[model samples]
Target: MRRRPPSREELDDYIRTRLALIGIDLSVLPEDDPDAPADQLRVLRSARRVLEQTVPALSDYSLDPQEVPPSMYPAHLPAVRQVAMEEGRPAPAAGGSGRPEEDAP
Candidate 1:
C-alpha cells in the first residue's frame, strides 16, 4: 500500500512540535546538565524556518524520485514537484537523457 507524503508546512509544524516535546522530556532529567548544548532547540527551530522560507533548497533529496524504482515513481512524483515549487524552484526537468550529469563526463 502507498502512503501520501505530508505537505512541507505540515512537516515543519511536526518538527517544531516534536522538538519542543524533546526539550520538555530533557527538562525532566534528574539534573540540569550544564554541559547540555546551548540553544539547541532554538537552532533547530530556526533551521526549519529557513528551510521553508529560503529560496535555496535541497536538491538530490534522499527521497527524490530520481533515486527510486520505477514502481514507486507513480506514487512520489507529485509531492516532489510540489516541494520543489514551494521552495521557489521549478519541478525537475522531465525526460532527461537517462544519465546522471557526473556520469556523462
Candidate 2:
C-alpha cells in the first residue's frame, strides 16, 4: 500500500492545536528578560523548520497521528507568542520622552 502525504493545511492545524494547549499568553512577563524572547523565537523557528523538513518525508502511513512518532509539541509556542507580543508593543524611549525611539531617533 502506498502512503499519502499530509496536506499543508493539516500540518498547520496540528501545529496550532498543539500550541493552544500550552496557553498562548504574552502580557504577564517583564519585557527585559534577556533570554525569554530568544528562547521563544527559537522554539517557533524550530516548529516551522520541523514541519517544513518533516512534512516532505511523510507518507500516508506517516500522516496518522498514532503512527507518526511523537515529537515535542508546542513546548515553545507560548514562549514565542509571549515574546512576539512583547516585541509588538511600543517600548518607552530610553530618555523617557514618552515617545517611541522611531520618533525621537
Candidate 3:
C-alpha cells in the first residue's frame, strides 16, 4: 500500500514547530494590520528561499496550493498566494549607473 500524504493539520504543526526552533514567533504576528498581507508574503518567500538555499534536499517542497489543503492552513492564504503569483517578474533596471550626470559637474 502507498503511504498516505500528511494531513494539513500535521503539516501546519510541523511548520510551526520548525519555525519556533529557528526563533520565528508566529503567535505574535499582527494578523489584522493593514500591511499584514504584504508582510506575510515577504515572510513566506524569505522562509522558502532560506530553506532552499540551506537545505537542498527541501528545494522540492513548493508551496503550491495543491500541495497544501486550504482548510487547515494558515489564515493568510491570500497573501501567500499573492507571493506565489509574483515570484519571477523582473524588477525595473537601475537608472544612469551610480555616477552623477555630466551636467552636474
By lDDT, the best candidate is 1
Poorest stretch of ten by lDDT in candidate 1: 96-105
Q: Write the per-residue lDDT of candidate 3 for residues 27-64, one digit (tens) a residue.
A: 66654455665454355545655553555434333344
Cand. 2 Cα-lDDT: 0.47
Candidate 2 or 1, higher TM-score: 2
Which candidate, 2 or 3, has the higher TM-score? 3
After aligning candidate 2 to the native by TM-score, how far in Å is the CA of 28 from where it should be? Answer: 7.0
Highest TM-score: give the candidate number. 3
Q: TM-score of every model? A: 0.24, 0.29, 0.31
Stretches of candidate 1 off by over 4 Å are 1-13, 20-36, 53-56, 59-105
Checking candidate 3 for backbone clashes, the offending pairs are: none
User: Which digits, one per residue and each the tens of the lDDT, describe model 2 over residues 1-105?
Assistant: 233656766765666678678976423444345567544434544576687666534421222222343564533434554565588843323221222334221
Q: Each prediction's Cα lDDT score?
A: 0.51, 0.47, 0.50
Superpose all Cα atoms of candidate 1 onto the true structure and report the RMSD in Å to 1 decimal: 12.4
Clashing pairs in 1: none
Q: Candidate 3 regions off by >4 Å? A: 31-35, 38-105
Query: Which 10 consecutive residues of model 2 have the lowest summed lDDT?
Result: 91-100
